[model samples]
Target: MERLQKVIAKAGIASRRKAEELILQGKVKVNGKVCTTLGTQVSSKDIISVDDKIIEKEELVYYLLNKPRKYVCTVKDEHKRNKVVDLIECKERIFPVGRLDYDSTGMLILTNDGDFAQMLSHPKFQIPKSYRVTVKGILDKNDLIKLQNGLVLDDGYKTMPAKVSMTSYDNTSNRCVLEMTINEGRNRQVRRMIEAVGKIVSKLHRMQYGCVKDDNLAIGSYRRLRPHEIKTLKKMANEGISE
Candidate 1:
C-alpha cells in the first residue's frame, strides 16, 4: 500500500504536492467514493480515479545510454532531430535522468520510473556527476580555481560550488583532461563554467553520474545495471522500488 497522493502522482495525474490539494478538494475518488482526506493510503487493488479518469499503472523501465554528441536528450524533438530514445529503440517509455547538451556526450540514465526520475533530475538530491572535459587552452592555477568555485552564468544565476581536478594534460596541444564533479545539474554548466573563466571546452565526456561509472563500456553500447549497482543506487537515493 502507498499514500494516495503518491499513487496519484505516479499515475501522472499531478505532482505529489498537487495531488494532496486535489484530494482535499474532493476531486479524487477511491473505489467510487470521494476521498477528501490528505493521508489516504491505497494499493493497486483500490480503484482510483481523478476527475472521472481512471488511473493506469505504467510499467517501470530503466535504461542506460552512452549518449553521443549531436544527439539531443529528449523523448521527442519538435524539429525531428535524433533523440536519445532513438538509440535505445525500446517499447517501454523512458526519459533521460539528466541532460547533456547537444555538443556534449556521456553516460546518460534513462527510466520510466517517475519517482526515480524526479529524485535524480531535481536539484534537492544533488547527485554527483563527473565530467572528463577537454579544454582549448591550458588552464593555469587561477583558471582552475575559478572553475572549482561557483560563478554567475551568462544567464545571471550563480552556479553551485563544485570539485575540479586536472586528470590529464598535454602542453604541446594545449589541451587538458580535467575531471569535474558537480552536485547540481544546470544547462551547459561544465562548459559554461570553464568558458566563463576564459577557456573553452573542446570536448566534454561525462565519466560518472551519482555512484555509477562507465567503466570501459564501449560507446554506442549499453548494458543493464548490475544487481550490485542497483543496490548501491538505491542506497544513494535513500529509497527503493518494489521490484
Candidate 2:
C-alpha cells in the first residue's frame, strides 16, 4: 500500500500537490467514493479515479544509469539539451531520484516509484552516496579532518560529517583526488564543501549510491535494477545505513 497522492503522482496523472488538491476538491474517488484525506493508504487493487476518469497506474520500473557528463538529470529540459531519461527506452515515465550537476557523472537511479525516491531523498534517511572528487589544491590531514567533522558552506548551512579517504595527490599536476561518502543531498553540495576548504573542484563523479555501484556499467550505459538490489536499497534507506 502507498499514499494516495503519491500513487496518483507516480501514475503520471498529476503532481502530488495537484493530486492532493484534487482529493480535497472531491475530484478523486477511491472504490467509488471520494477520499479527501491526505496520506490515505491505497493498494494496487484499489479503484482510483480523478475528475471521473479512471487512473491507470504504470508498471513500477527502476534503472541504474552510469551517467555521463553533459546530460541533464531532469525528465524534461526546457533548453532541449541531452537528458538522462533519453538514454533508456521505457514505456513508463521515470525521473532521476536525485540530481547530478550537468558536469558531474556517476551512478544515478531513475524510477517511477515516487515513494522510493522520496524515501531516499529525505535527509532523515541519510542515504549514503560516494563520490570521486578531484580538486585544485592538496588537502592536509587537518583539512580532511575538518571535512570529516563538518564545514560551514557559503550559504551558512553547515554540512554533516563525511567519510573521507585520500586517493592520490599528483604534485606534478597539483591535483588532489579523494573519495567522500556523504549521506545528505544538497544542491552542488560536494563542490561547495570542497570550496569551503579553499579548494576548487575540477572533477566530481559519483562512485556509489547506497549499495549500488558503477562497477560494470560503462559511461552513458544503464540497466534495470535487480529486485534484490532494490530491496537492499530500501532497507538501507529505512534503516539509515550509511554504507
Candidate 3:
C-alpha cells in the first residue's frame, strides 16, 4: 500500500505535489469514493479515478533527448508551440525532468517515473549540469575566476560557485565561448550570470546533466537510456553529491 498521491504520481497522472492538489480539490476518488485526506493509502486492488476517469500505472520509460533550440520543454504549451515531448515518438507519456529555456538547447531527460524525476529536479540532489555558452564580449581569467567564486544575479540572489573555463574567443567578432558547470538549476542562470559580469549571451547549449552527456546524439534526436545509465542515475539520485 502507498499514499494516494504517490500512487497517482507513479501512474504518471501528475507529480506528487500536483496529485495532492487534485485530492484537495475533491477530484480524486479511491474505490469509488471521494478521498480528500492527505495521507490516504490505497492498494493495487483499489480503483483510482480523477474526475470520473480511471487511471492506471504506465510502464516506466526513460529517454535522453538532444533538444533542439526553439522547442519548449513542457508537456503542454498554451500557445500550441512545439514541445520536447512532441519530438519523441514514444507511446508512454513522459515529461522532461526539468526545463531548458526555449532558446537554449541540448541534453534533456524525459521519463514517466515521477519519483525519479523528482529526485533529479530537487535542488538538494545537487545534480551537476554543464553548458557551453557564447557571449558577445570576451571574458578574461579574472572574469572566469569571479564566476568560479560565484556572483550576485540581477534578481539579487547569490549564485552558487560554478566551474567556468574559457573554451575559445574570436577577436574579430569580439565574442568568446566558455564552459560552465553548476549544480544549481536557476532560471536562465548561466545567461544571468554572464549578464551580471557585463557580458551578453549570444548562444547557449547544455552539454551535460549529472553523469549523462550529449554523447554524439544528433540534435532533435532521442534514444533510450541504457540499463547501466539508468542504474547510474538511480545510484546518483540516491547517494546525491556524496557519490
Candidate 4:
C-alpha cells in the first residue's frame, strides 16, 4: 500500500503536494468514497478517482523546454493565457517541475514523474539553476559581490549565497548582463535578488538546471531529456552539486 497522494501523483494526476490539497478539498475518492485524510493508503486492487475521474499510473516522461515569454507555467490559467504545458503535445499528464515568471524565458522542465519533480523542486536538494540575466543598470563590482555573498530581500528573507559573475557591461545603455547560479527556489528569486541590489531585471533567462541545458532547443520547443541528463540530475538531487 502507498499513500493516496503519492499514488495520485505517481498516476500523473498532480504533484504529491497538490494531490494532498485535492484530498483535503474532498476532490479525491478511493473505492467510491470521499477521502479527506492526508495519509490514507491504497493498493492496486482499490479504485482511485480524482475529481470523479479514475486514475491509473502513467508511463513517466520528461521534457526540457525552451520556454517563451508570456507563457505561464501552470496546468490551467483562468485568464486563458498560453500555458507552458500547451507547448508540448505529450499524452502523459506532464506539468512544469518548477516555474519561471510569465515574462522570463528559457530552460524549463516538464515531467509526469512526480518523485523526480519533487527531487528537483524540493528546497532540500539544492539543485543549482543557472540564469543569464540582463539588468537595467550597470552592476559594479560591489553589486556583484553583494549578490555573490547574498543579500536580504525586502521581505526580510536573506537569500542563500549565489555564484554571480558579470558577463558584459554596455556603457551606452547602462545595462549589465550577468550569469548567476543559485540552488534555492524562492518565488521570483532572481528578479527579487536584483530588486534587493537596487537594480531592475530587464531580461531573465534560465540557462540550465542541474546537468540539463537549453542546448539548441528553439524558443517554445521541447524534446525528451537524454538518459544521462536525467541520471545526472537524480544523482545531483541525491548527492547535491556545487555552483
Candidate 5:
C-alpha cells in the first residue's frame, strides 16, 4: 500500500512530482474512477491510467557526474536555469543526492533509487568530502593552526575540527590552493570555513566525494556508475538506513 504517485513514477508515466500534479488536476484515474487525493494508495493489481493512457514500469538508473559551476542540482529549475539532469539526459527520473551551490563544482551522484538516496543523504551517515579550494590570500602557520584547532563562526556555531593543509601557492597570483576534508555536509560550510579566517574563496572544486572521484571526468560531463561502484554505494547506504 503506497501512494499513487509512487506507482505512477514506477510505471514510467513521469516523475513522482509530475504524477502528483496530474492527480491534483483530476487527470489520473484508478479503475475508471477519477482520483485527486494525494495519499490515494493503489496496489499492483489495480488498474491505473493517466489521461486514459496506460503506463509501464521503468527500470531504475544510477549515475555520477563531475558537475561544473553555475548548474543547479534539481531535476528542473523553476527559473529555467541549467540543471544536472540536462547533461546526463536519462529516461529514468533521477535526482541529486545532496546539493552543490551555484559556485561550487564537484562530484555529484544522481539516482532513481529512493532508498539508497535517502540513506546516503541522511545526517546519520557521515560522508567525507575532500575539496580543493583556491583562495585570494596565502594562509600563514597560525591560520592553519586555527583551522585545525577549530574556531567559532559569526553565527555563534562552533564548527568541528577539520583537516586543512596547503597544496600549493602561486606568488604571482597571490592565490593559494588548499585541501580541506570534512565529514558533515552543511550549507556553504567550506566557504564559511575559509571566510572565518578572513580569506576569500576565489575558486572551489571538490576533488573527491565519499568513494566517488573526479578523475578523468571533465567539467559538466557525466557517466553511468559501474556495477561495483553502485554495489559499494548500496552497501554504504545499508550501513545507515534505519529499519
Candidate 6:
C-alpha cells in the first residue's frame, strides 16, 4: 500500500505536492469514493482516478536532453512556446527534472519518476552543476577571487562559494570565457554573478549536472541514460535522502 499522493505521483499524474493539492480540491477518487484526506492509502488492486479518469502506473523512463536555446523547460508554457518535453518524442508522459533558463543551452534530464525528480531538485542534495560562460569583459585575478569568495545578489541573498576558472580571454573582443561549478540552483545565478562583477554574459552553456555530462550529445537531441548512469543517480538520491 502507498499514500494516495505517492500513488498518483508514481502514476505520472503529478508531483507529490501537486497530488496532495488535487486531493484537497476533491479531484481524486479511490474505489469510486472521493478521498480528500492527505494520508489515504491504497494498494495496487484499488482503483484510482483523478477527474473521473482512471490512472495506471507507468514504467518510469529517463532521458538526457542537450537542450537548445529558445526552448522552455516546462510541461506547458502559457505563451505557447515550445517546451523541452515537446522536443522529445516519447509515449510515456515525462517532465524535466529542473529548469534551465529559456536562453541558456545545456544538459537536462527528463523523467516520469517524481521521486527521482524531487530528490535531485531539493536544495539539501547540493548536487553540483557545471557551466561554461562567455562574458563581455575580461576578468582579472582579483575579480576571479571575488567570484570564488561569493557575492551578495540584488535580492540580498549571498551566493554560495563557487568554483570559477578562466578558460580563455580575447583581447580584441574584450570577451572572456569562464567555467564555473556551483551547487546552488538559483534563477539566472551564473549570469547574475558575472553581472555583479560588472560583466555582461554573452552566452552560457551547462557542461554537467551531478554525474551527468553533455558528452557527445548534440544540441536539440536526446538519448536514454545507460543503466549504470541511472543506478548512480538513484544511489546519489538515496544517499541524499538518508543524510
Model 3 TM-score on a 0 to 1 scale: 0.95
Where model 6 places Cα greater than 4 Å from the true spot, the runs are 241-243
For residues 124-150, could you state the per-residue lDDT of candidate 1 as single tens digits? 667888889999888899877787778
Ranking by TM-score: 4, 3, 6, 2, 1, 5
Between prediction 1 and prediction 6, the one with superior lDDT is 6
Off by over 4 Å in 5: 1-43, 46-56, 240-243
Superposition TM-score, candidate 4 onto the true structure: 0.96
Q: What would the per-residue lDDT of candidate 6 be over residues 65-157, giving only the tens digit for each residue?
A: 999999998898899998999988988889988889999999899988877787788777777789999999999998899899999888887
Per-residue lDDT over 1-243 for candidate 2, one digit per residue giving the tens place of the 0 to 100 score: 999999888886555666788899999999999999999999999999999888887888999999999999887789999999999999887888889999999999998877788788888899999999999989999889999999999999999999998899989999999999999999999999999988999999999999899588999999999999999999998898776
- Overall lDDT per candidate, in order of appearance: 0.80, 0.90, 0.89, 0.92, 0.80, 0.88
User: Sort by lDDT, best first: what order?
Assistant: 4, 2, 3, 6, 5, 1
Q: Candidate 2: where is the Cα deviation over 4 Å?
A: 9-37, 40-54
Q: Least lDDT summed over 10 consecutive residues: which range in candidate 1?
A: 234-243
Candidate 1, residue 199: the lDDT equals 88
**Which run of 10 residues does model 2 get worst, by summed lDDT?**
10-19
Off-target runs (Cα >4 Å) in candidate 3 are none
| Cα misplacement distance, residue 11 of candidate 6 (Å) | 1.6
Stronger candidate by lDDT (3 vs 4): 4
- Estimated TM-score for each candidate: 0.79, 0.87, 0.95, 0.96, 0.76, 0.93
Model 6, CA-based lDDT: 0.88
Residue-level lDDT tens digits of model 4 in 171-220: 99999999999999899999999998799999999999998996788999
Task: State which candidate has the highest lDDT.
Answer: 4
Q: Which stretch of 10 consecutive residues in model 3 shows the poorest summed lDDT?
A: 234-243
What are the per-residue Cα lDDT tens digits for candidate 3 across 1-243?
999988887887777878899999999999899999997978899999998989877998889999998899889889988899998897887899989999998999999888888888888888889999999999887888889999999989998788889989999999999999998898889999999889999999999888888568999999998888888877887887822
**Superposition error at 224 for model 2 (Å):** 0.8
